[model samples]
Target: MSDQPPRDSHVYDGPVGGWGSAKGIAAVARTARPGPGAFDTLRRQNKPGGMMCSSCAWAKPPNPHIVEFCENGAKATLWDLTSARCGPDFFASHSVSELSGWSEYDLELAGRLTHPLRYDAETDRYVAVDWDTAFAAIGQELQALDPKMVAFYASGKAGLEASFLYALYARAYGHVNLPDSSNMCHETTSVALKTVIGTPVGTCVFEDFDHCDMILHVGQNPGTNSPRMLHPLQQAANRGCCIVAINPLREKGLLEFANPQSPWQMTLGAPTEIADRYLQVRAGGDIAALTGIAKQVLALDRTQGGVLDHAFLDAHAHGLQDWMDWVDACDWAELEQVSGLTRDAMEAIGAIYARAKAVIGVYGMGLTQHVHGSDAVGALVNLLLLRGNIGRKGAGISPVRGHSNVQGQRTVGITEKPELVPNDALRDLFGIAPPMDEGWNTTAFVQALLDGKAQGFVGLGGNLARAVPDTDRVAAAWGRMPLTVHVATRLNRTHLMPGRSSWILPCLVRAEVDMQDGVNQQVTVEDSFSHIHGSIGKRSPASPHLMSETAIVARLAAATLPASAKMPWDHWARDYARIRALIEVVYPDDFHDFEARMNQPGGFYRGNPARNRDWQTDSGKAQFTRPAALDATGLGVGPGLYRLITLRSNDQFNTTVYGLSDRLRGIEGDRMLIMMSPDDMAAEGLVAERRIALTGAADDGIGRRVAGLRVIPYDLPRGCIAGYFPELNPLSPLSRCDLASDTPATKGIPVRLDLT
Candidate 1:
């Protein structure tokens, strides 16, 4: 055998100057290999004249700072500005087959695409194509298909104007298949909230944290997912606001968040205490825990003769009788078995809820990505209703969203189930009827691919392949498509998933100038706080060849739509203000002064139905609903099988891996490990550090098994196990989603484990 050079030291020492030594050190060490730009990325973050928070949409630059940002924000900034660049020559040298073998990180690190490229299957390589030919080909393919056959996907990273035009084009062409990021993250919230509140958005404002006495966070990690949220969380905890975290994993940031803003904090390493009570529930057991709390609260109300806001429930809620009967009928034994919390723990949580003057219930994907996700969320809302938490100051339901403008994108008409087409508004604005019928969601879109019924896919700025579940299955499904058009900022794994003819259209990054009609136009982003702020990129584009997302979208729209549509497609390309004007018409009441609000310092909240107790349910009152419990008999006759919940890391986002480190979990470099209780591991005859294989229980005909999963014993509840998503997505069949929402139960997969 040929002699191989000695491998680099597997051991990871602390970084220079003692920074990122422990968790960060271990985090970076866990990655297969470090990105070349990791070290210099942060240095360039605050360089003498680099992009600053002042230019970011999440930040209010003119206002005095008070813990203005989070670690994830810093990571996003650094990752985007990294010195990695994969130019035209890189693609010229490597064939699609060769590049397909590389990992997500390696492909991303190769850098930005300098020009538009098309894959030529005969030559087995991608060749550079100019904007004109690329647009023409995409238009030709789109025109050939019945618009309904082509699906349009929108990512949260897409801008409002781009998304608006995208929605118009899809509807104008009569195809309603607009599956978006919301499908994966908060679609359940929409399904549940809309049924209760008549609107899909949240009821609380970001400022409510300052006024609330208690904040109940379930399954949301502000530390990693929304770093900007940490400031409010810390501020609330500091001001005697009771913070309760209910999650399977004891996240590091939820316990203590290090504020990078405070001078004292920065110098002395001050970390703020977050959760006053940490409830470690088992995976997929949130519904039971939440329902148990509700039962206790209801019982206490009866005992005390004043626990629930009976008057509020009477006036503002419907279906109370049904809700009460369901809660009363739940067996304590079943609840306890499913929730894995003691009676005392349940009472303790109930007392907290009953005593708090005002409380806010905030959740993330944990409450949404389950088999009964919508009903689970309804249970949470039912608990809030017992206390009259909704429609009150400092207390309401807040779904902390991922991606900057995901909520905004949904608000701007990107939906598979859009409400009736307001023909009057369409005629007054576009002078035509937009598609009124329902369309495909993410799950439905993927199903279409599997059936080989869909011919084309137009992704408007997202890594769809990695974000969706069962990547290998979807990869094979995508191969049947005749055309795939991707408009993106940089090259991602999605770009390499080629069809017969693939077009990669390069677009400007959100943090770069978007010039139109010989002038730099500013775009706006809505934050988790329901505040819309102006964003103008301070840095130059990664390359001069890229076009603004708006322009690319407009070009495609113009090419695909017919002349008889009576819409001014060409005008939208030269300016986005017109698009905002159209938005005002569509959402006239909410976005009354879109332009003026866009220019304001502190962005304004569009609507707060709860502020005035404006319950818009069918009965003019908030309705309570729940799904029947999972049949214990259905849970295979075995002790070793359990539900598996997949989660994101502190250093990562949804399907977008910045690095392999998870700072909160005390995990360094691995994403394939399972977090299980020591007793559970011992009972199964599994070692703590040994590798295991996780096989899924049957769901449809698609069964999956992930091997070589490192088992890490933690303080998790028995019958509960946790693993990272995308890596563990193979173990979750696409059919295993919530019935009401079609959200893949990534949080609840029945699985069996064995030593590898």
Candidate 2:
């Protein structure tokens, strides 16, 4: 063997959530040094009247563990509660041009923003400004521009109370361009679920895992994205529930798991195996694999009388015959080729599903961030419907949401679609004639900026500049905006890209106390399971100048809108309960008894009507959807061209990079490496650690390219490559997106790699 550095391709054989997880948490603690108080905050996470984890949106169990927090949750908490501070002095020391050169990790790791800041073009640096001055300037700018020229972008981190106020403020200003994080990640799920089951949210709860006999996990890496999910997968595995992992990579988390909280398992070095069979489906081939499995089930139903749920189908489902005919028309050879799997494997998975009485289908961005993501999600729902897996205990579709409260933001009227908003109710309650036209989603917002149509931007929270596709172009467009106001806790890439008149308003994080009108305040967040719970911070605010998200929105609304009886901005700012009361008034069905139930342990469940067999669709029944095509990517595959899939490291959450090391993937100190199959490397005459350049094959004439990405040969299918996101986000053009959901095809972009 050649004497060279190890090619960042070591396989991680250890079980998920063992000592490795413990080490990851410890590392974050060391880096953050959140002090002894952080331990108390960690202990209170996901508990009754406790703060929700700032990481993933996994539901908390009714009987919570003493250590309910996971490794990722601990990292996020520590990160939020870090002792480091980014005050006026820090900004005074560094210019925007200089700070723009820093890495994303360094920008966030520098510390929390302590004071509100306004960009001073004369000095090319940010200067401290009082809240009143900043708000007045922003309000004046908003007054000058048309409502349609401004876009209000909400991050998933904002709580329901804050999000409601933000949406209210946008509408009160006569604008509805409320683009949020959901527009990028789970918008496909929302669209597909609504079309099929008449609901936008998932139908399953945390307890469903306990009763599920089989779980079909597709396109999601629970280990890295949502580590808390491992507990349920472990329990289901221990009880002999057959789990079939359907994804391109054989993720270590789905293979086995050792609960770090369990002393017995950790001490014994024993881990419960997770997936009984791992199907390595090709990137963007989810529809084909789903169709292949459904075809096998249909064949089995034809030969065996008890295979299909005829009773459930006849009463609750529509368009079954058309869907079955479409599935029948799908050629097995074509499916095998597109899915990169054998027919026998699909048959095996179908057999397991046929034998199991209850099955749950779990998926993530891997299915949604595709060219045909809506179709792929519809296909998965169709597969689950064949066996009557929906609307029953232990069986339903679970889309693993990335950010906490992302779903809640949409539920509380933070959507761009006019139909989803309670326009009449808002008009009657708030005495404001909110815009009825559909506004900009994320993609449209970016396009508006690129086209110079957008004049102002108000971000509730998020690194919009780095998270979206066409990073360089988006940043350029963002910089050209007449005004930009960001409400955030820390310094992010989006904050650095100052517009002509930009402001960064410091806000309190989830782990910090929010005292309003001399009383402690609690905000509510809805989890992936549609359970709404209250989160009250235990620790003091990171900075004295930091304002609560609700307060920021309230004050901004007060500054922007004229004095009106219906819009009680000051009252809402004084007490968050007032905002929750309005939320209850707006969404009485979901938020009924909002205060009483929100104080209860684990809060209350926002019941899914579909769960009770009450289909809210146009036809009054769940509909079976036909896949547009077998290939979900809709990208051309050819020699020297590879389909790219973006991934998140174990050390990273959505856009927050905690560290450079990815313990689960055995990657360290680097984020620019590309993961490719050994066979593909050989075919391309590329060796491990060979630097290469990838150019996107988008037909929009935009040259999307990134260079100097070292290749690491790994266990993946041919004609496929993987890289960490935000780094590879440049290769994803804005034009290459799902038309139905407008979600960037980040998971399946066609690219050509050449040796650099």
| Best by the TM-score measure | 2
Q: Mind giving the per-residue lDDT tens digits that candidate 2 earns over 387-492?
A: 8999999999999998999999999999999899888999999999888889999999999998999999999999998899999888777889999999988899
lDDT of 1 by residue, 1-756 (tens): 111112320112221112342334344333324244433333333222222332122333334354243455555654565555667788878988888887666776676667888988886777888888998888888888877778999988776788888888888878789998888878888888888777677888766677899888998776667666677788898899888888876666577765655656655755677888888776666788888888899888889878889899888888888878988898888777777677677778898889988899999887888877887788788888887898888899888887778877777788887573355676577765767778999999988888888889999888887778777788878867988999876677777778888989888775566778877876766755566665566556777888888889888888887765457777867888888888888878767899888756556677767567887778888888766653211233356678787888766767767676764555766678888877777788876678888988755666678898888776666787888877787777778677777877788778888664
TM-score of each: 0.91, 0.98
Model 1, which residues run further than 4 Å from truth?
1-67, 267-270, 420-423, 630-637
Q: RMSD, model 1, all Cα superposed?
A: 6.0
Off by over 4 Å in 2: 1-9
Clashing pairs in 1: 26-668, 30-669, 86-110, 86-111
